[model samples]
Structures are given as structure tokens and as C-alpha cells.
Target: MAAWNLYRHRNSDGSSKDWAVRSNSDGSITTRRGKTADSLPGVSNRYGVKQFDIERQKQAKGYVLVGEVDIDVNGNVVFPGKTSATPTQLPEPDANPMSVPAPPVEALYWTVDCHAKQTIRVELGIEVRRLIGVIQSVSDQQSKPEQDWDGWQQFIDATLNAETFELSGQIKSVHGVLPWLFLLALKAKSFKGVEIDIATETARDLSVDLKAEQDVLVFFGTDLDSIRDTAEVLGLLKPRLNLAATMSDTDDCWF
Candidate 1:
């Protein structure tokens, strides 16, 4: 019945934290010292045996249980056919506290699922693509007299403004357009409910993932006049990319 006597780290005031337990090739169990984590056993005899009076012995010294694992009767720390659960052993900190590595940052991400409103999304996508094409065509056909970039840009902006101009567009619409509708409303003078419900949800989820390292501002419009951003612009936010997705499909695309 030999097993690991897990011990967690706690503050002097008895608050608990996620410090790793210490185990060795031998059946012995111990814990690291206060304030340091992922380190080797700093305090000796911290882990107490469950089968004997060892639990009382360690508790007397203020050790807390974290978890446990079964050991073999041979007393050679029989690792139960499981992958190594040992936490990574951290090296001693440098004399300069700042020299120590910063704790790993949990990646923040945001997910926008528009599967429910695929019909509207595809429609919007088609219109947006068409408008984008018109803009590009106008820009490239500078030598042509028929090109009308300004008119085309205004048309797209007006279209986007009419169909889905603000955050309420998503909330008020049949389906949730979310970031699509919400981001547009930002250009408005003043609006409400942006920070509530879906908006706050997006923030709490930390789903702001993008290929670029800098912040991205995605604008859904028809023209590129004010598109080429300044120092404030990190990158243009694009639509949700699907693998092998077509540029435009009669059934899939709206325009």
C-alpha cells in the first residue's frame, strides 16, 4: 500500500498555491521551500506516509497534502505504469531577481462562430468581395477613364452601413454576427451595450488571435481610401479563414 504523499505549498497565513510535490527514485517524499516553485525538495521529511504515523509527524510541522501515487512493496518507488508526472525541475534563481525567467503567459484567444448565420455571412462575404474587387479594379485601372474608385468606395461603405452598420446589427439580427457587426458600431459617435453580453464575453474569452504580432483593426466596408492605416494601424483584420474555401460560389456566395 506504499504510495506518494503529495504536499502543496501554502503561505505563512495558510493560503494554498499550485507548487509541485517532490518525489525521488527512492520511495521518499518531500516538498520545496516556501515562495519557490517547481524546485527540488527544499524541506526534508515534508511528505508523510499514510500507512503509518507519518501523517501526524509531517502535519505537526505544517505540511499539506497535494496528491498521491501507489508504490511497490519492494520500496524502490515502483512507478505505476504511468507517464512521468514529475514537474519540471526549475533551476536556482540568479542573484539578480530580474534575471529569473518570467512565468509563462497563458495565451489569450477569441473565437467567433458564425456557423448559424452561414447564409447571411456568405451573402455579406460575396457583397464584400465584390465591393473589394471593385475597389481593387479601380485602383489598378488608373489609366482607364471608366474607373471610379471614389464612387465604388462610397457605394460599399453605404451598403455595409445599411446592412450591418453597428454592434446592434448582430444582437438585433436573426443571427449573431458578433465581431462583424460590433466592430462597425465603433465608428459611431456613441453607442450602448458594446461592453455587455457578447462584447464582454469576447474579452473574457481572450480570443484575440491573429497571425500578426500587433493589434488588428478590421473594417467591413467597400473602399480603401482610409484603409491604408497610419502608426495606429497594426494590420487589417480578415474574415474567418476556412481551408480550401472558394473565392466565390453561386450557392455559397451571396453576391
Candidate 2:
């Protein structure tokens, strides 16, 4: 590993001073500015040089953090950290060019609205029309004490006119045991691969086990890749289609 030592003048202010990396072999600085190598060697180009500045720095060489990085090696290009391999010689291309695999295409992600198509009707006592075990948000999260089943009917009248549905993770003020049973009725009707009998609302949480079914795909909110994969498998999106689209989409909002 060839190296250089930069320096600034012995008598100078810290800011405006000459600096250069002295070739380790020649003892002469390889880089120079205005007044030549006057020895202002505070910071070094590589990480090791910075350490040298801190421990055994000479007054002639002070250090400064600069915009550019300097790698003193010569000839074939050398990557940082790894010192052995030279990038100039690449692995020989496959004799049959067609044998080489193509770069994978981008993935496409699409939001599914199957729940929106499904709705609830109170005409037959708040029965679900489509998917039997679908969870629906009550118009009010907290069922009022004074508000009885009659009030629930009134709530049904005022809200739920639109086809809006609920995501699995929302809970309002406080829900009582009876409301839980109301929601769990769907689970009773839809014992599709569901084995546990949900006697209470708390049981509803564990009644549906996605892992028990071999053909079901369940993704946690954090599992963005699996969700995208499930969407693709269901024909909701094409293979390798990423909604982020741009290479610069660094946000974890999708996750």
C-alpha cells in the first residue's frame, strides 16, 4: 500500500495554510497548492491518516477535513477496505452470452379494494352480505350505555350508507363484550379452515389462524415484501412491479 504524508508550514494560522500528501517513498509531497507543501496536515484522506493526526501529529503537519477523498494506490483500480483484489480484471463473460442471466425486472405493487365491494346490511339484523368473517367497524367505537340496540339501529341508519369498511387495526374509545359477540357471528358462520370456537370477543382474535391453511397469505403491517408478493400471486399486480417506481424511493412508508 503506497501512501503520502501531507503538511502545512510551521508558522501559519490553522485555516489558510498549504497542505499536501508527501509520497512515502520520496519524502516529497505529491499534492501541493499556492505556496507548495507548507505542511498543514490536520486530516488525512484515508481513515488511518486521521488517526495519525490525533496521536503523533507534528506541528508542520496539521489536519483539515476536505471534500475530496484521496486513495494513494497506483495502476489498477482498488476498492476501499479490501486490499487484495484489483477490479481491472473482471470475471470472464460466459462463453455463451445467452447463458448470462438478465437483470430482474422491477416489482409492481397494487392496493386491493375487495373489502370495499363487500358491505353490511341491517335489514336482516346487521348481516354481512359477502365474505362471512369480515370485520366491520361499528359506527361508534364506544357503544353508549343509554344507547341500546335501538340506538345501534339508528346508528346503522345514519352511518354505513356508503360502502366504507374497516381495516383490522382500529379500536375507538372502548368496546364491550356484547359488541365483540356481534362481530364474531361472522366467524361462526365462516368456520372455513377455522377450528377454534369463538365463545367471546377475545377468542375472536385467535380464532382465525392464517398459518393453518396452506393456501392463505398473511402479511404483517411491517411485512411489505410479503404483501406485495401476495398481491402478485393473486393477479392483483404483475411480477416484479414496485409502486415506489423511482430508484430514489427510500421511505419506509410502504413497509
Predicted candidate 1 versus true structure: per-residue lDDT over 12-99, tens digit per residue: 7845433223455565444333343332333443221222233322333344555554433322222356533333332222325455
- Residue 94 lDDT (model 2): 35
Off by over 4 Å in 1: 1-114, 141-255
Candidate 2 residue lDDT tens string, 1-255: 343333334234433443444333332223433222222224323211222222122331333322222333342212245443222221222335455453331211111011222233232223433221222333234234332332234324333564332212111113222232333344444422222122111111222332332122211112334434433333333578456665447564466
Using lDDT, give the best candidate's number.
1
lDDT of 2: 0.29
lDDT of each: 0.33, 0.29
Task: Estimate TM-scores for all models.
Answer: 0.18, 0.19
Report RMSD for candidate 1: 21.8
TM-score of 2: 0.19
